[model samples]
Target chain A: MKLLEERIRQEGLILSAAVLKVDSFLNHQVDTQLALEIGREFGRLFADQRITKVLTIEASGIQFAMAAGIALNVPFVYAKKKKAVTLTEQVYSASVHSFTRQETYQVSISQQYLGPDDKVLIVDDFLATGAALIGLVDIVNESGAELAGVGCVIEKSFQEGRGLLEQKGVRVHSLARIASMSPGEIHFVDDPSPAYLVKEML
Target chain B: MKLLEERIRQEGLILSAAVLKVDSFLNHQVDTQLALEIGREFGRLFADQRITKVLTIEASGIQFAMAAGIALNVPFVYAKKKKAVTLTEQVYSASVHSFTRQETYQVSISQQYLGPDDKVLIVDDFLATGAALIGLVDIVNESGAELAGVGCVIEKSFQEGRGLLEQKGVRVHSLARIASMSPGEIHFVDDPSPAYLVKEML
Candidate 1:
């Protein structure tokens, strides 16, 4: 987690009050070695869960989920943003609203892949509004599988995602927890701050 | 490669002569360990190339790309199907036609990640029409990067993909090459077919 935080400080670009661009090494273009380490961290964190599957949404989350799957030695399933033509079968689905994309999309997984027999660990790149992660959690619940927890590579702790998942009793872990950020300066939950997070902790 | 061929024979569903679904392992629900082996196989095949980067399109190709990146001890980059809100910079892009989806989409990679100094190995889950792979190949060319070759998890050898790639003077390697398949029967190029393959070779 510290290494991830270090990468975030060194390479992460703070675009605005909310947008953090890690395209250099995380989502868009990836550091495969770093991704593997992140996976190992997730594996260590959730080592006792007896996870049968690792789940995620398509595109961004696929790498982390696959990494987690590699670490956990389990199969990873990605819920497609749209039903592909070949996916002609019963499916478990949930709708997710993307604040960034400014649109809604349905995420689905084939029913044959997950059921009561599976224990799931959902993973993703960013946890902000919690919309997409919540949708995945709903799908996991719908599958009648035991939900172990959710793992995120980078988390916007200021956002409502963690709070919402906590409300659902979902154990959540994020590698980099950003406390606050702007164009030039950034604060992490782990950063020693004369900032609000420390005051909030008080 | 034999293990991959065996998995295809045992679990791959022949939805049609053209559509063989290996969603249970390769794409949707990925067997992380097998995917790792596939990556290692790609690494072995392209070992002589001294690849500096591994590339693929997002969603499906990511797992294999990351796996290859792992085996080769390098980074991987995925082209985005759409320019996301966060991706405001210039990019190298190419348009692709999806036969199955009956649609066309632009795939783009940031201009920062690839360049003349990098040697790329493009990896993907399928080589059917070769449309997407060709798009990626063009992107690599546009970036002034050196493309070592392309590695595919499975190849529908009966399709035009291999021919088109060969026509472009690009090297192609596929773990399992299906000579032909139908509802119940699947034949690999490696299969001792009383089929067209042996005769064509003769």
Candidate 2:
């Protein structure tokens, strides 16, 4: 977690009062070695819980989820952003609005993958408004699977996503939680509490 | 490679004589254990090369690329299918057509990641049309980086992708090259060449 925090400070760029760009290391160009360390940290955090599978949404979340899965020795299942012709099976679907893209898209998981006995740990690169995480939780519920917890690489705690997930009784753990981001400056909260860890950043 | 071949024979499904579905283990639902093995295999295959970075496209390709990156102890970079707010820097862009999605999309890579001094290995889950691989290669060329080779989990030899790549003098290694496929049977090329030996079947 400290490694991730240090990396964010060193490479993360503040675009404005609201945006922090981690393209250098987290999202665009990945530090795979660092991701493995982050994954091991998450594995250590969730070692007590029985995590059957790690789930995440497509694109950015896939790499981090795969890292955690590898460290935990569990399978990782990613919800597709779009439905392709090959995806013919019935799916557990949810509509998610991307604040960045400024549009709504459907996120889905093949019904064949998630089962009633599975305990799902949702992972992602960042948690902004929590719209994506909410959608993932919806998909997990639709599959009749139990929600183990949520693991995130970086979380914007000032946002409302954490509150939304907490209201639904989901445990959230983030490696680095930003308390606030201003012009060229970023602050982090060291508390690991699920509630403040996700929603109190602003 | 043998594990991948066995997995395909046991869990892979052939659909309508056209589609090969390994959704249970490869793309949709990823088996981390299997991917760990794959990462080790790819690392071994490219051990002699000075691989500064592992390059791959987002979504499906991220998992295998991460696996190989971890195995090889290098950073991995994934190209975005679309531009997001998170991606604000100048990038090398290319047009790619998705065979399964039936649409053409632009793939972009941050210019910050690829450089003339970097030696990159392009990786993917499958090779059918080779359009994605070509686009990745184009980006690599645009950045003036040397491409060590292309690595694929599965390659459909019946398709023209491999030949096209080979014609361009890009060495391609596939874990499993399907010589041919039918409604009920999937045939793997029994003997792997020197180039194929580096490739494994997954």
Candidate 3:
């Protein structure tokens, strides 16, 4: 987390008060070593839970989900943004609205992949507006699976995302929690003793 | 490679002569250990290339690209299928026609991530029509990067993808090369001594 926050400070571009671009290393162009470290952090944080599967949306979240899957030694499922030609079976789906794109799209996963026997841990690249994450949680609930919690690589704490997830009683953890940001400056929430590091030391 | 071949025969659904679905393990619901093995196989195949980076398209390719990046110990850059709000800078773009989706979309990569000094290896889940792979090759050429080769998890040998890539004088390697497939049967090209395996034993 300290390493991730440092990388954000060094390379993250604050386009505006609401926009933080980490394309240099996080999403567009990825740092494989850093991604692996992030996965280990997630694994340590959720070590107490018996996670059967890791879930995420397509495109951006795939890498992190894959990393978490590697760390947890479990399979990861990505919900497709649209139904492709090959996906002909019955699916569990939820409609999500993207504030950045200003469009709503249906996210779906095959019914066979998740059911009452599964324990799901949802992961993603960013947590802002909480629209997509909430959609995933709904799908997890619809599939009759037990929801372990949500994990995010970077979180915009100033937004309503954390509040909304907390309202639903979903345990949420993010590596880098941005307290505030401007055109040329950014701030992160201070944590003197992080839980993952404490666990690592023990 | 034997493990991958076995997985396909056991789990892959031959939807039609043209479509073989491995979503249960390769793409949608991914088996992390298998993916890591696939990556290690790619690493063994391209170990001599000194690849500076790995490249692929968004969504599905991220997992394989990440795997390859891990095996190669290099970063990866996934070209965005569409221009997002945060991607405000100049990019190298290409248009790709998807035979399955029956539509053409623009794929773009940031100018900052690639250059002439980089040796890029492109990885993907499938190499069927080669439309998407061709688009990525063009982007790599435009970026002035030296392409080591293109690696695919599965290749439909009956398709025109290999022919097209070969015509461009690009090296192509696939773990499981299917000669043909139908409702309940699949055939693979027999290779008694794979080149990568020979290199590994040496």
Candidate 4:
């Protein structure tokens, strides 16, 4: 987590008041070594849980989920944004509103991929408005799968993401929590909670 | 390679003449254990190349690329299929036509990710028409990166994918090469090459 926070500080580009571009290492281009480290850490944190599968949304979240799957030695399934022709008509679909894109798009997972017997952990690159995460939880619920928890590389705590998930009683773990950010500086909130302690350690 | 062949025969679903659905273990729901084995095989095969980075296209290719990255201890970069707010204006973009989807889409990689000093090994789930593979190759070329080769989980050799890639002078290593397939039966191509034989020994 420290390494991730450090990388964010060193390589993460703050594009605006609400956007942080991590194309150098996180989303567009992946730092696989760091991803594995983060994955192993998540595996350690959720070792007690019965994680049958790791679920996430497509594009950025796939990398982190893949890394966690490797560390936990569990299969990872990602919901696709675009409906491919191979996907069947019977699917677990949810609409997610992208704040950046300013558009709502449907994310879906085939019913055949998930089942009632599975215990799933959701993973993603960033937690902003928590729309994508909510969509993932919806898909998981549709499959009758148990939602173990949610894991994210970075979470902007100043946003409504954490509060929304907390309202639903979903346990959220983010490697780095940004309380506030401006230009080249980022501030962290001081707390003894697990998420805060993780940030403090970072 | 035998493990992969056996997996295809046992678990892969031939939905129709055009679609071979391996969603149970490959695309939709990934088998981390098998992915790790496939990763190790790729590592062993491309071990001599000294690959600097593993290049792939999102979101299906991320898992296999991550597994290979873990085995090789190298970073992996996946091309983004859509233009996000975080991406820069200047990028190496290429059009990829999806046979499954019956549509053409743009796949782009940032210039910062690939460069002349980097040796990129392209990884993907399936090599059907080789459109995605060639798109990746174009991105790598635009960045002036060295192409180590291409690796695929399954190759439909009868589909002209291998021949197209070969025409581009890119060496491709497929775990399971299918000569042909149908709803009733699937025929696998004989591994006449030494590399495939070595992969089988693994």
Write one digit per residue (lDDT tens) for candidate 3, span A33-112: 99999999999999889999999999899999999999999999999997877787899999999998999999999997
**Can you write out model 3's per-residue Cα lDDT over B1-202, one digit (the tens) per residue?**
7888888877888777899888889999999999999999999999999999999998888999999999999999999997978888889999999999999999999988999999999999999999999999999999999999999999999999999999998999999998887677778886533222111100
- Candidate 1 — number of clashing residue pairs? 0
Looking at candidate 4, what is the lDDT of residue B151? 97
Q: Which stretches of candidate 4 lie over 4 Å from their true place?
A: A190-202, B191-202
Ranking by lDDT: 3, 1, 2, 4
- Judged by TM-score, which candidate is best? 1
lDDT value, residue B196 of candidate 3? 21
lDDT of 2 by residue, B9-87 (tens): 7777776455788888999999999987888888988999999999999888988998888888998999998887767
Worst 10 residues of 2 chain B by lDDT: B193-202
Clashes of each: 0, 7, 0, 0
lDDT of 1 at A110: 98
True contacts kept of each: 0.90, 0.91, 0.91, 0.88
The TM-score that candidate 1 achieves is 0.95
Best by DockQ: 1
What DockQ does model 2 achieve? 0.76
Q: What is the C-alpha lDDT profile of model 4 across B1-202, one tens digit per residue?
A: 9999878877776666557778778888788889889999999989999899999998889888988887888989888888988885588999999877778999988787789999989999999899999999888888999998999999988898889889989999999998776674677888543221111100
Model 2, range A65-158, lDDT digits (tens) per residue?
8878877889999999888556778899999998877899999989989989998889998988999999999999988999989999998999
What is residue A110's positional error in candidate 4, in angstroms? 1.8
Better of 1 and 2 by TM-score: 1
Cα deviation of A189, candidate 2, in Å: 1.5
DockQ (CA atoms), all models: 0.80, 0.76, 0.79, 0.70
